[model samples]
Target: MIREITEQAWSACALRLAVDEAALRAVAEVESSGSGFLPPPSQQPKVRFEGHVFHRLTGGRFDTTAPRLSYARWDRSKYAGSSLGEWQRLEAAVALDRDAALKSASWGAFQLMGFNHAMCGFPDVERFVQAHMAGGDAQLAAFASFVDRAVFLDPLRRHDWASFARAYNGPGYAANQYDRKLAHSYARHHVPGSGTKGTIV
Candidate 1:
């Protein structure tokens, strides 16, 4: 299901936080194309296995599943077991290892991982999942909290693509050109406003 926050709410929060609304818009554009959700539920959400995360969460118990230790491990497999897509793989992984499964998939428009609940100000993973299901408002709140927790606010505010992408998307951000995408998207959506960067619209 796709979820979207009210424009008023989005703007209000961005203005209140003195965040660059355009920069946040940039993140949304790249992360979910301006929505905190995938398209309607005709199909399941996309999911990719993070083998290294699987090993780390499982304490090397499933390391053989990957057969090596490298960040490339996250992309080595497109599915887990026989299941494909986010829901299926997530459920299958949950059956085997709940916490690890939650940590595996990125969620919402910001695509915050389930393991980030605490950092996003939620007490538990369940709460984090529920927030994504709740609405775009919750998702955006979580997104805001997430960037804050990851210390990407200033980076985003300054359009410091490298720092923002590195912290938000991990060390592999470059592989996806996350920083470049953010920069390009930011320019597309940026508007002159109250703060040093865009805040309106």
Candidate 2:
């Protein structure tokens, strides 16, 4: 149904997380350019398949048959570089192992990994994918849950982009300049003198 997150949803998440709205917005922007779904007519949540994750989940079984969908290590060169292409790769892996394939991809605006479903308050990878497919509000809710469980609220509240990026994006965040991009996005979204304190919703 293409249920995108509304401004009210963002504000509610900010209040619940006790962080500035801009912080959440910045992460959303840097992670998925502030949208959860792919271009219209698809109604599919944005996704990025991680072949390394697929490899881990399947014990290298598909590594030989589906090298592009399952690799032992992260390889940017293998990426299709488009939402449609990524979905195609994900579907190919799904044909091999449905569970592992679903869990091997990052989903939605926050780009939360399916393996993190538990941390994000979902019972399983399928539930996680369902939530993401429900749209951005669900995606943001999952992101908030993850932030709380991962203890990223403090860093986000303090505008500690480096720490947030390192923890949220993993140790390889620096290679992608995620922290810098987050900081820049935050600056663009932050209102002067609004402070980083949580506002009453």
For lDDT, the strongest prediction is 2
Using alpha carbons, what is the TM-score of model 2?
0.94
lDDT of 1 by residue, 92-192 (tens): 66776777867766776677877778988899888887888777778888887877743687787677998999988889999889999999888877755
Instruction: Specify the poorest-scoring 10-residue window by lDDT in model 2.
Output: 192-201
Query: Compared with the true structure, what per-residue lDDT tens digits does model 2 show for residues 88-180?
Result: 999999999999999999999999999999999998899999999997789989998999944588799888999998889889999999999
Estimate the TM-score for candidate 1: 0.80
Question: Model 2: clashing residue pairs?
Answer: none
Model 2 scores a C-alpha lDDT of 0.87
Per-residue error for 134 in candidate 1, Å, reads 0.9
Which numbered prediction scores highest in TM-score against the true structure?
Answer: 2
